[model samples]
Target: MSEGNGPTEGQDKVQSSAPPNAVWPLRDKEGNVTVPFAYGTIAFWQGKRAQEYQTHKWHVYVRGANNEDLTPLIERVIFQLHPSFNNPTRVIDTAPFHVCELGWGEFEITIRIFFHDGPEQGLEIKHMLKLFPRVGEPSQKKPVVSERHDEFVFNAPNEGLLQRIGMCNTRMPNGGPAWATIEPFFSPLNEHEELLRIQAAQRRVQAEITLVKEELENEEQILSFLQDEVKKLEPSIVKKPPGT
Candidate 1:
């Protein structure tokens, strides 16, 4: 009976204690899940965290041939965030600005402009990708295709926060391509306003100069007429003006 009780006691002890061979099946043997890569998604990871994680978002663009209105494509742009990356990825809202539904042949892609909020908050981008239709389907298999990654880098020396809001510079990561020139996001109205101000100032100065010259000419004419009248009156009064 003691021998029989010993096996029962060992079984009870094992049941009371935690199972030694218990494992979480969701994770791999190394505690990492395999993730496949694909196009139309920007892959990025946070550097500081110990837990390995990845993020992905769909890419959208507006195209044109030559310089024309390609905004139609932009209006129809779509946003699709991966389930794993949605929490960390930024989403764009497009309620503020008016979107025109006209397209040109030239190509221009719009992206969420990211800015550092503070030490605690990670970078935030105004998610504006919901306006268009989804373009390419996401791939599921391995050996992922390399999508055309259009990344912009800035080397600003004295740009303020306001100035940096819309400034963009296209550059390649990992020294693949040379840095391009900085570009601004000003509309046509801003440029037109500046030109109109300069032209109006020039016109005002020209009008002032013309008015002064006309006044001087009128004064000289009046003086000449008065001198002639005086000469004619002297001849009539003295009766010897013709001989003089």
Candidate 2:
């Protein structure tokens, strides 16, 4: 919502699921397979990211589902930045699902998060791109930034997926979950950190919007007061002679 977890303000429940031989993804005490939650986020930054580039710069970042760092958990994350971008689709297998490019146009980014041979069905999330001040406008104010959060509920997940989730959350035994390991197999840091960064940037835009609204309200009040004062005056006050 405004400043909370997935499903943004307008949309509710980004995603959920089901399957027969499926068990919940995660587990808690009493050896029960619990439903696992995956958080998805999309963030954008607008400015001159590259000095030599003539066009404006836009930076986009994606946070994996469930706040799980895909760097170590999944095989790769694909991002379809935009049609204008040369070779728009990218396969990322690192810390940041970030892309930097030079352009004045904005489009929707389709992101696919896939896991390696875990038999777990992949997830998809899309975000609309935004750039501050629009095209052909002065960049006097802070760049227009936007961040969205969404989540998926993995219900009745396959056993393999459950094992994958267990391995990710450190519920594994000796080395890790029998299917996977703990050490470098899963990222040490959570992906929510990136989401926090995005939210912080989005807050700047929100603050600016609030300030602009307040200024507009003040101006309207001043104008209304002036109108009232004018009405209080006699029409003859500013009336001029027939010929001057």
Global lDDT for candidate 1? 0.27
Instruction: Give the TM-score comparing model 1 with the true structure, all chains together.
Output: 0.21
Task: Tell me each candidate's RMSD, in Å, in order.
Answer: 27.0, 17.1
Residue 165 lDDT, candidate 1, scale 0-100 = 23
Q: Give lDDT tens digits, candidate 1, residues 220-239.
A: 99999999999989867845
Choose the strongest candidate by lDDT.
2
Per-residue accuracy of model 2 over 121-202 as CA lDDT, tens digit each: 5778777766544566545234445554443345455666556555543221222121121122222233467568758989
Q: How many backbone clashes does candidate 2 have?
A: 2
Deviating ranges (above 4 Å) for candidate 2: 1-55, 64-68, 117-121, 133-141, 167-244
Cα misplacement distance, residue 201 of candidate 2 (Å): 26
lDDT of each: 0.27, 0.48
